[model samples]
Target: MSGFACASSCGLIFKSKESERNVVSLFQYDGLRAVESIRLGAIRCDPKSSISTSAAKCGRIKAMASPTVSAPKREKDPKKRIVITGMGLVSVFGNDIDMFYNKLLEGVSGISPIDRFDASEFSVRFAGQIRNFSSKGYIDGKNDRRLDDCWRYCLVAGKRALEDASLGQEVLETMDRTRIGVLVGSGMGGITAFSNGVEALIQKGYKKITPFFIPYSITNMGSALLAIDTGLMGPNYSISTACATANYCFYAAANHIRRGEADIMVAGGTEAAVIPTGVGGFIACRALSQRNDEPERASRPWDKDRDGFVIGEGSGVLIMESLEHATKRGANIIAEYLGGAVTCDAHHMTDPRSDGLGVSSCIIKSLEDAGVAPEEVNYVNAHATSTLAGDLAEVNAIKKVFKNTSEIKMNGTKSMTGHGLGAAGGLEAIATIKAITTGWLHPTINQHNLEPEVTIDTVPNVKKQHEVNVGISNSFGFGGHNSVVAFAPFKP
Candidate 1:
């Protein structure tokens, strides 16, 4: 049997004798020559190659003009791997990562009555108000006082994340500072400053506005200030896509490494919008929950009794480094940032598209970019904001792409932290990565009644033990901006 030639695929057997040499020799011929050679008789095929079943009837092997199987070879990525080494955030829960996640794990609500100002007249009087906030170590006291809370949040979060990644001033001095970058941003940058400036201008005239007003009130200042502080000469800027701002910054920052542009990036979002103006604007749009009576139970995504989102305020920043750079520095890696994608609904200003096409496509593209299969993702950090239209729309979009029905478990972390506006993605990304590291899914606190639209398990009310090898965090904005980031537990 070993001496005999065979077409294992088509089950054709040919003897190794000289009488069958015509068939054995054809295996080495070019496609056309093979076809001609096979016509002589006793067709044989290499065991490694496939032969059509029609060979029995035709008594000959077909040949091709080309050498390959027809698909074009994919070019390999030559750049370094991008990873999340450290993350830092100031949330209503706390500044510590363990404290922030443990609170959510216990299913505790961070939402409370807005303590930053008198929100009594506003329709929504409560929020995830950040408390005992200070930027003393991260920013100079004089500069901290001069800048708006948004800038302070950005600087504090950015510096803290760098320190967490061991890229502090001392470590940075030893490396190429120009190869690092910053991309922190806020949806409504310096809203507090802008609101105060406007109020002063209206009451006492333009002269009442401070000289530092314009520089501090712009949307780009968050990224600008971080770059100025870190001296990162590489790609540095802020991108505003409302709530999707964090994911957008993350996506762009990862690409900067993948494209060989930067070795490290400080990316994510920060915002302090618990003020009178921020709450008032959302109240005017009726986008805030009216469940002021029970502040703890307000931000209930996928709940039948849910009304709207509870406004959350704070900052979440991450230090992203190319694997080469992080490995060389011997940094502690937290997670692997696999891939991400962005899409626009282009249907409405503040409403999502009814068809759910934008979000579905975005998820598919993100998975494709990550080289991940849909079934491989056992966990999903939903973007459900507790709004009537928004929550269901996201559920439907998720349903469209994930068809395993019950294998995937989705959770609404907003049910605890509320919606963090532009910083939501950053906050949620941390939650997702923590789940990957801890093997625990933080519960959706206020899910008293799950909606029919949610067929996937929400892991409601209490923390559940689950393995999170791969996961995604979703973030969508009022302007129909949809962004998703794919991540996994660090393996190398």
Candidate 2:
């Protein structure tokens, strides 16, 4: 006979062979007992065995027993939500988000001659240049000269976004500063600073180089400066994924809030790579357009005669906050970040996957994360940088994911603003948010003739307003990185 443990009112009992061997007590619990009742084979308890009789017969006993119960699961509080409260941008197309959107909707192109530096001998002379921006106004005069142009752009964008969100000095002083964070990204951080340092070392010697060169060139300094300026102590860092940098940064910020790490995050990207070396490098790779005479028509995405991207520089920033935080502070929520995804082509270091497999997977994954159906996306801000392979690859990827729904309205903002490289994702994100809020979708200017193999509907020439519930933005860059972001109108 074997033994089994049971809860008895008074004591423990063992029912094996009564006179066979010494009784062995199994285990004990408060007010319960281990009772063994023989039935068949090795040992078993009779179903109708009386606990009172068994306990009375056996000598093993214990005190009162407590009931076995499992701990209750912690319920997730649904009160917290993420919302975009404000946006700011400094683009080749315009300085403010609204101005940029208006210019895009009017189909205005910002590409022009490379006057920022001497690009006369370069194969690609045209670029989208930001005009008349004074960083000294944003940064203190004493510190303005110490920072690289990229950091200056980020500071301006961050300050504007905070102001737009009405997160004034008074508001910031009243909040938990430690719960606020900053996440800024750059594909080519401080390239200008590095180039300048190299030039100084070659021409004037090591003593000519500035002591601030290292800090200015490092990617994380921008975020650090923004944090210092705004007093945000929460999770602060910089993400670098080439062209996918900004989108990945925003994705990281959103996850931080979701995981209860931070209540607010200032996230975006900045780039100031329009100098001679920047343009010459892209020209060497034949990745930039050479249409100097008609600079405005240089970036023509989806057009059969398209040549290459027009290098541009700027910054785009958004004030992202938890729904609970915004609601408690009575902040105006602009839009909600539904979801985003990132992937690697891995097929090539520079070229996209020939079959667009990675790009398609990224799009589908983003939709899945957003809890959105393919058919629900009414507009897509394509990363069509006007490069022959890049534009067609993205088109093919969209065709693969959307299939029958590939006919959805698509616009390439690069056509007007030029490709801002690392900052493209953030700039395009701001455009997407504006599209949802204002109901105005911009057009792909200079797309004179659409390619037959490219199946997606390209919005060309004229701006139009349509009821858009959901939208997506895509950005892909060198090193085979791809990222997609999904946005939807705010419900609450």
Provide TM-scores for the models. Answer: 0.84, 0.83
Pairs of residues clashing in candidate 1: none
The clash numbers for all candidates, in the given order, read 0, 8
Query: Which residue ranges in model 2 land beyond 4 Å of their true spot?
Result: 1-80
User: Quick one: RMSD of model 2?
Assistant: 26.5
Winner by lDDT: 1
Off by over 4 Å in 1: 1-78
Q: In angstroms, give how far residue 23 of model 2 lies from its true place.
A: 92
* RMSD to truth, every model: 21.5, 26.5
TM-score, prediction 1: 0.84
Give the CA lDDT, 0 to 100, for residue 299 in model 1: 89
